[model samples]
Target: MPKWRIGYRTLKTAIGAALSIFIAQLLQLDFYVSAGIITVLCISVTKKESVRASWERILACLVGLIYGSIVYELIGYHPISIALLFLLFIPTAVAIGAKRGVVTSVVIMLHLYTIEGVNVEVLINEILLIIIGVGVALIMNMYMPSNEKDLTWKQVRLEDCFRSIWKEFASYLRFGDNSWDGKEIADAAAFIEEGKEMALKNVDNHFLRNDDYFYHYFKMREKQFAVIKSILPFISTLDRTLIQGEKMASFMEELSQAVSPGNTSAYFLVRLNELRNELQQMELPQTREEFEVRSSLFYILHELEEYLLTKKKFKPDPKRTKTVSAKRLNRDHEQRDTK
Candidate 1:
């Protein structure tokens, strides 16, 4: 069973609709109820989307009014004229990237149809309705709830998944334990997708600046995850009894513990280079099986290096960190005061 809950968006939509209707009614506009419907349609998940949708609707409504008026007057203001009006209106709206506003514009066209023709008073009333409805939606969308906390939580979860995956890799290398169902890989991928989406929404919320640090961070993790997945087949093909596997397992365990929102890749890279050097200096394999296992281990190391290099180019967004810290401090203060 599913539960129904009123989220912030739903609340905003309700308030925006009511406010639009109230303003339209207060202004004595005809078809005031249509303003509420427009508000409902205009409210969007993100501020950017809301602004774009409002623009599209406004532009489409204008086009519909002009076109519908000409068509209605020329074609006798009959049902056939309306069909003719819509036949071109839809495609014209789409061409102008105002498809979202087609329905709203249709409402205006109907108002014109109801009045039998266009007039200054009715035109003003419809324009006022558009302005009031879209304005209310924009105002309601202005207070988009911050996604910083959600993004931060996702970042933490993604890092934890990475750590778990690395530990699983280490366990497999050290004990030949293939018991890990590789769930962390899937979980990390899901987290990265969710985080990227939320980060994009966060960026959309900020009009004056780019909040794309979290987005970049998630992208970096995505690259590293791909590398990790490539290393899996190599790991599974390895001979558990190989001495080289132990050293790689130890390195992976250390690397797993060091996963954080900081640049420690350089240290790991140095250690990895040293491990490669030590492997190069060792005695050559005595048989084909040993050579094959060593080759797979080498490939695993190469993939691990690629994984760290992906993170090497990434630097945490300091401004985002500070903003999040400030928000947390304010929240803490509020909690203390309430207590």
Candidate 2:
């Protein structure tokens, strides 16, 4: 957002504008400045977008040129004619989603009006100027300097934050200490949200889906992080020794390490089940206070299960197959064939 933060796109746009003007002048076009203006307007952040802008402007140019010629030659080049052309064409352009090209379109129409007529020669020249301007912008946008590295770095930083948070959760569970700051949880959420925005704004907004959705991964992580914070109350209210807090701490530590995208959370799910079994095997609390504490611990385990389940559900181990059932079905088929 800073004025001095001229990115690669800005440099491309400036260069394209200059090139467009030079070409128009070289070609001896009457309105060379118009070409530069068109080029500046056509240059966009993405190559796809620049091409689309150029196409829309080219179409809009034709609309304005055709209409301007009719108005000037048939009616006359007067204030009333210009106003009438705009009244008719602006709504037409807007209806066709070419409203973005309205400025460049008006410029083309004004050029026609300036000449007081649009004969065959003038039309050809206008078309050439439009092409030179729009084409230059398209070429400028064709190969953007790759920001993939920056996006990957951001992803890595976000994952690192998640790992640190998980590690903290483990430590908190292991030792009932107020050593950690709650601001870290807030910081993690902020990082995820911001990282998500950047990732979404990156090149692959259309094709990226399901597992490739960088934003989805972080959003899911944030949801689990909220649940992780929910466990803090259980940690605070209950006596740490009475609950199987050490087991949870160990599970969280392992979960922290397996936080990367590639790591399938099968091991974490297995550990969670083991912890559930362990908790279930223990004697039920007899005292009311003890029961409440145990219930809180149960709630923590339940939330932890949900967290692990979310990870497993979303990112299952691709290598793991449903081969056991398939094998049984195959054997049955073989037996039937023999029969």
* Residue range 152-182, candidate 1, lDDT tens digits: 8787778879889989988998898877888
Residue 284 Cα positional deviation in candidate 1, in Å, after optimal superposition: 4.0
Query: Can you write out model 2's per-residue Cα lDDT over 1-339, one digit (the tens) per residue?
Result: 757788787898889999999998998888888888888998877655676777889888899988888878878989999999999899988888888889999989998888886788899888988998898988887756654445455555556666777787777766776787776667777777776766555543233332245556666777777787788677776665755777777777887877665545677777778888987898988899888877877898889888777776565233222332244357669989999
Question: Estimated TM-score per prediction?
Answer: 0.92, 0.78
Residue pairs clashing in model 1 are: none
List of clashing residue pairs for candidate 2: none
The lDDT for every candidate, in the order shown, is 0.88, 0.75
Cand. 2 Cα-lDDT: 0.75
Q: Give the number of the best model, judged by lDDT.
A: 1
- Candidate 2 RMSD computed on C-alpha atoms after optimal superposition onto the true structure: 11.5
